[model samples]
Target: MVDNQSREMAATDPSAELVRLINGYQISQALHVAATLGVADHLKDGSQPSDTLARACSAHPASLYRLLRALAAVGVFHEAEGRRFSLTPLGTCLTGDALGSRLDYARWVGTPGMWQSWGNLLHGIRTGEGAAGFTCAVEAWTYRDQHPEERAVFDAAMTALSRAEARAVTEAYDFGHFGCTVDVGGGEGHLLKAILLACPDARGILFDQPQVAVTAEGVFASAGLTQRCQVAAGNFFQAVPGAGDAYIMKAVLHDWDEGDATEILRSCRRVMPATATLLAIERVVGPPNQDPSGKSFDLNMLVQYGALERTAQEFQVLLNSSGFDLVGVIPTYSPLSIIVGRPAPAA
Candidate 1:
């Protein structure tokens, strides 16, 4: 009762929002702990006593009860009369077996590597270098490559995000006209699978690093696309597969700064046919004080990769410099937008 009164009082206070924002890490960490313990999965059946949940999760009963009640106060779970808890609508998204679930993403964000990098955000701002270099002694990609477990977690997180965004992207744009589509740096082929499923006639080429490309074979085979989709492995900075009617690089270019991003676009242009279209799926930063998600994502890029999300104008410049004309920017239901480009006319 006192807690509820305090909450109401805080809600009416002008500075309460700022205080909550400052303590946002508590919510994030709590969610991470719940996700890591598969709390939502266990709660999917029905409400259970906190002690039962703790026993199932191998957690301390008192500590787990405290965590669940806190999450309940935030609407992630529901607290009943005897310390029993049930999954709320928001909590359901954390279930590992659910389609488009954010389970892996929750796990990924709370990893020590990500925590350490974000913790050193001040260093990144001062030095104009990624915190990954300072914290892990390497760039983000190299750090993940060296840590196999972390790489797997990161890959799963990417795949989870792709699963959630795939339908939105496919619905926003048409790929049926293209005879062949190439997914550059497509991880685990979730987006590519969604595309092929939507456009039955369009064959696909899933391209990525050798180690990454191998994992997509199973994804394609399981999707019954092995005969129609070919998994190719190589470096995108050097070259991409040729003859694709449409080439897609989703969430790829944002990992690099201007120079390297331009080089990637150029590499795509070198192999792309005059008739082929280029699609860069990424978040476009919005005007000042708006689009908090995009702005925060830009900061994440800065901290982890020394990169920044581009605006529409910046995307146009990159495309033009890479011998392509910016065709259009297509928005989807998701945060990502498809920035379309086509080969420029000869001089």
Candidate 2:
């Protein structure tokens, strides 16, 4: 006879998994609410009665208890005696003070702009245009530019994301050889700071738009790299800093379609010494039925920016068009990969 566990597994309803997948948004929104209310931060010390948490969060006592109980059911928090709740290991990721905290990313996902764009994903699929442009009547970047509050949240989200990946990227690749590393479109300089920290002998140029690059000074200062790093403000489409031994564009090219991406690369090429190396740090889409995370990110890119995550072959083609020869793709512990390239031979 089959064992009890095997029988139970066999008896499970197939539709149950589909139902959970369909209701995934509920969990996302719940996590967003907790992050916004700083619930995880409050629970960092120890378990507290739901009413106490409610007061701390300025939320309705009974309602907060319900939310806590629900999150407990989902393994985000552990509900104890007397309706007290404590953060589970999974929940610690929502704490703002924690290393690799995803608080800002959760907040960004629940922001109005992101919700509106994803809600209109069908429109993008049907029209071959970004849902953000269709729904917001402006491109996503322009929308953020118009709303300072949203822009701040978006920037924090990007920095949080970069912080989570920076260590893995640095560990997977060696940057010690390059004397000067220029991070093209490096917002807030998280990755550059990490690289500088890892390679004590190397200096860096943090380059981005004026508004974005200006905020990186504090990041460098906090890392004690103020003297070694220079913040350069400019548009990557127009120009990038020159005289760097290595150039990095992390999570940058995926924000644009092929034409715009190639132009950005060409701008870096225009100034890069033939000896300098270029690294495009991004997700390399895997073959069919694999790399689900990358494939899902590709869909989000379509909805939000009318762009995509590329396959290895696509990256090679893109590099060739932009005056670079593909060297090799280096994998990191994280989902992102380092696509190494060099300037094509002079014709």
lDDT of each: 0.92, 0.93
Clashes of each: 0, 0
Model 1 steric clash total: 0
In model 1, which residue pairs have backbone atoms overlapping below 3 Å?
none
Report the C-alpha lDDT of model 1 over 132-245, residue by residue, as the tens digit.
789999898899989989888898888788888898899999999999999999988999999999999889999999887998999999999999999999998899899899
Which predicted model would earn the best lDDT? Answer: 2
User: Stretches of candidate 2 above 4 Å error?
Assistant: 1-11
Which pairs of residues have clashing backbones in candidate 2?
Answer: none
**Residue 301 error, candidate 1, Å:** 0.9
Off by over 4 Å in 1: 1-9
Query: In model 1, what lDDT does residue 200 have?
Result: 94
